[model samples]
Target: MTETITRPLSTEEVSEATGIPAGTLRYMRHCGTGPRSYRLGRSVRYDTSDVAAWLAAQKAATARGGDAA
Candidate 1:
């Protein structure tokens, strides 16, 4: 089986995919509360897998009888 390559997403792409506003996404980054991101020289990129993992973690946290606050 051939391995699939996942492309990194731009901030706008990530915001579109997650239904989050671009400004909110930028604020999250500034607050360091968003999914892990990387800086490529001057461009910012988010991994789809990282976003999915963050969602799973949020679900698990909520499932543990704790409020995300």
Candidate 2:
């Protein structure tokens, strides 16, 4: 059996997909509030599926009237 590998997305790509600025993404990294990230040395990368899951979770929270506070 063979496992398929998916390329990890750069911050710029994620920014384009999520409309989140790179700086804010960096802040989220620092605060651990955003999607899960993989730190490969100095490079930060995200899995698209993880980002999608996080976005779905955020939407569900909003639908439940949960605040970031």
Candidate 3:
């Protein structure tokens, strides 16, 4: 049987994918207001699924006139 492996994304990659600046992503992480992430050896890693889920949550919040930050 064959299996697929998905690796986590770096801040730069996430910035490119979401159009959010890398610095902003870092700041968000510091403020605990960004997508879920984890530390992998001294680097922060973000799971693709978590990013998608976070984006969805932000969209929902915005639609409901809640703080989307």
Candidate 4:
């Protein structure tokens, strides 16, 4: 049997994927208004699934013509 492994994304990768600046991501994280994240030792990571869900919510909000928050 074979299994697939998914790894968490780094901040830079997330920024590239979302078109959001890394600094903004850091600021959002500080303000508690960013995608869900996990901390391991001195590094921060984000699950691709969580980021996808967050993006979906943003699209839904945009379609509804309201703040994504």
Model 3: per-residue Cα lDDT at residue 20: 98
TM-score of each: 0.76, 0.81, 0.83, 0.80
Write candidate 1's Cα lDDT for 1-69 as tens digits.
Answer: 997879888899988888989898889999998888999779899988998998788777777655578
Model 4 over residues 21-68: C-alpha lDDT tens digits? 999988988998888888978899999998899889887767855556
Clashing pairs in 2: none
Model 1 misplaced stretches (Cα beyond 4 Å): 1-4, 63-69
Estimate the lDDT of model 3.
Answer: 0.95
User: Residue 65 of model 4: what lDDT?
Assistant: 55
Q: What C-alpha lDDT does candidate 1 achieve relative to the native structure?
A: 0.87
Best by TM-score: 3
What lDDT score belongs to each candidate, Candidate 1 first?
0.87, 0.90, 0.95, 0.89
Off by over 4 Å in 4: 1-4, 64-69
Predicted model with the maximum lDDT? 3
Residues 47-66 of candidate 2 have per-residue lDDT tens digits of: 98899999999988778555
Name the runs in model 3 displaced over 4 angstroms. 1-4, 64-69
Error of 4 at 41 (Å): 1.5
